[model samples]
Target: MSTTWITRAETAADIPTVHTINAAAFETGAEADLVDALRTDPSWIPGLSIVATDRHDRPIGHALLTRCHIGTVPALCLAPVAVLPEYQKTGAGSAAIHTALRSAADLGEHFVVVLGHPAYYPRFGFTRASTHGIGLTIEVPDEALMALTLDPEHPLPAGIVHYAAPFGI
Candidate 1:
């Protein structure tokens, strides 16, 4: 780990650049737009949205964990994870993801789901959510829906995921 690359809880000051990073990293504006909507809702869990900052403290990467549900059980949803185009493959995104997951675990969040690259997410301890009988209401690639039990004492819940209101899922 590079000491120069700092991972910190996002402050209001970092929101704009973090959004910019997301917009630049993705082909479409959906992720950046989703982050904007999340900030306005009751579901925004402070400290769950974290940033990886450069030495000068400018955000170059971001990872957000927001409230969701597996049946009636509360869980977290990881989405729109992004790093600046130049920072991809350099571990900036990984650092932000790790920091966010650690914070979620510390907050006693029991489970988290992500629809992402199958290979990449497993490196973070995510497994096939279907094996646990968890799925989404919307259609998606089977291998892309993954989950992680942040608190091993509480096994992942099983049911169709209902994302926060702001997510429109």
Candidate 2:
């Protein structure tokens, strides 16, 4: 198990490996299929889809950031983060997420929303979205939906999140 995972923006060649990671990480193919659908969705932000690779440069984790809206304000959605089952607790997923968020920040994106584990996401500076008056139209566990402000100057906006079509939200 390599502790040092290399994170980078997804390249054309990494697509298959990414798909496999999603498939292998989740019990169903829904997440992997969503990745495929998101690829062609208008919300797709090319460089925001990131992967974490092993020492041999084989992708073992994936993270995607796509266009979404918080009220009328532009924001990003972090979804379907996956790490190979064998690498579940090895920080591969974390590296991919940190890298994707950093890329989003560098690209001038301000707010990000993620429907994920409350305990896990907080390490990345996420807080319950309700704290910022954010919510989803669809029902989700309150604590599972979290938000982060990439830029402190621009606080998270208040509104229902509009996820991409593929998300069916």
Each candidate's TM vs. the true structure?
Answer: 0.96, 0.98
lDDT of 1 at 103: 99
Error of 1 at 166 (Å): 2.5
Cα lDDT, all candidates: 0.90, 0.95
Q: What 10-residue stretch in candidate 1 is worst by lDDT? A: 1-10
Winning model by lDDT: 2
**lDDT per residue, candidate 2, 53-127, as tens digits?**
998889999999999999889999999899999999999999999999999999999999999988899999999
Which stretch of 10 consecutive residues in model 2 shows the poorest summed lDDT? Answer: 51-60
Expressed as tens digits, the lDDT of each residue in 11-94 for candidate 1 is: 988888988998999999888999999998877899999999888888898999999889888999998799889888888888
Quote the positional error of residue 80 for candidate 1 in Å.
1.3
Candidate 1 off by > 4 Å: 1-4
Q: Write down the lDDT that model 2 would get.
A: 0.95
